[model samples]
Target: MQEQEVQRGVLALLQRIAPELEPAQLDGRVALREQVDLDSMDFLRFLISIHEQYAIDIPEADYEKLVSLDDIVAYLRARLPTS
Candidate 1:
């Protein structure tokens, strides 16, 4: 997917995960747990959402690489199979 599409998907999933969240509340450079106020389980669910959406395998060790919206977008963009 394109960068814009990836962005949209991330934001959409964020909304699904936290309906009370506002898009402006997320800082792309900040940790997602900080921005979204997610506990360990919540964060795991968020990661699972991304993995399910993109059909990607995300090992536990690599979770840190997806700490922010920008990070998630960049990671998926680089790893997603080309159509």
Candidate 2:
């Protein structure tokens, strides 16, 4: 998937997890939990949403690598098969 598409997907998932967050407020480089008030459960839900969307298995050990919007986009992009 394209970067913008992945970003939009992340934002949409985040909206479900934290409705109060505005897409414009997200900093690509900042950690999602630091930028938002999402707790551990909320964060897990966000990750699950991403996994569901892409049908990609994100192992628990790699969860830390997806701490930011940029990271999530890149991580998912790399895992997705290029068609």
Candidate 3:
């Protein structure tokens, strides 16, 4: 998938997990948990949503690598299957 597509998917998933979040206002470089009201469970749900949406396996060890929007996009773009 393209970078924008991955970013959009991440943002959409984040919104689902934290409805109050404003995707347009989010700073991609900032940590998602700090930017939104996501607790550990909510964050896990967000990661799970990503895995379900993209069919990518995200082990717990890699969770720290996905702290920001930029990170999530890069990580997913690298792992998502090409068409």
Candidate 4:
């Protein structure tokens, strides 16, 4: 997928997990947990949502590295199959 498409998917999943976020607020730098108040359960849910969307598995231990939009995009770009 293109970067914007993946980003949109990620942002949409985040909206499902944390409805307080506005699309405009997704600046790709906001710390996710801090901005969304996501706890462990929410974190897991977010991971599951991402996996379901992208068909990629994110191990539990690696979730901490996904603190920001750039972080997630970089990680997912690495993980995803090259076109």
Candidate 5:
């Protein structure tokens, strides 16, 4: 998948996880926790959901890199096997 497609999928996944968040709310520069108001546990849940959905094991150390919507997409794009 292309990077743009991964970003779109990440955005959709986030919306599915957090219904309160709209696509407009998540930009590349915005911090996921600060901008989205997700606490640590909430973020963990979000990560778990992403992992479950994508069948990708996102390590905790890698979590630091996932600071925003763009980051999440990039990380997933890099880690997920391309078809």
Candidate 6:
């Protein structure tokens, strides 16, 4: 998968988890939880959604690495199989 694709997928999952999020207003460098005001459960759901959408395993230990949009995109880009 490409970077844009990964980014879109992340944004989509985030939107699903937090419908009030405005994608255009989001800062890729900022923490997602801070931007969207996501609680622990919502954040967990976001990770689960990413795992389900990409068919990849996101181990609990790596959760801290996915704090921002940039981080999530980089994480997914590194794991997703290329076409």
Best by TM-score: 6
Candidate 4 Cα RMSD after full superposition onto the native fold (Å) = 1.5
Candidates in order have lDDT scores of 0.85, 0.89, 0.88, 0.83, 0.79, 0.89
Per residue, candidate 2 scores C-alpha lDDT tens digits across 5-76 of 878988999999899988998899998889999999999998898888889999999987888889989998
Task: Give the Å shift of residue 72 in candidate 5.
Answer: 1.0
Error of 2 at 5 (Å): 0.8
Error of 2 at 79 (Å): 0.9
What count of clashes does model 5 give?
0
Better of 1 and 6 by lDDT: 6
lDDT of model 6, residue 65: 95
Q: After superposition, how far is residue 34 of candidate 2 from its true place, in Å?
A: 0.6
Give lDDT tens digits, candidate 1, residues 1-83: 89889888988987887888888767788887887878888888888898889899899999878888899899999998766
> Against the true structure, what is each candidate's TM-score?
0.89, 0.94, 0.94, 0.85, 0.83, 0.95
Ten-residue region with minimum lDDT total, candidate 6? 1-10
Candidate 1 residue 82 C-alpha distance from true site, Å: 3.9
How far in Å is the alpha carbon of 70 misplaced in model 4? 1.3
Task: lDDT for model 2, please.
Answer: 0.89
Give candidate 3's whole-model lDDT: 0.88
Candidate ranking (TM-score, best to worst): 6, 2, 3, 1, 4, 5
Give the local distance difference test score of model 6.
Answer: 0.89
**Global Cα RMSD, each model:** 1.3, 0.9, 0.9, 1.5, 1.6, 0.8
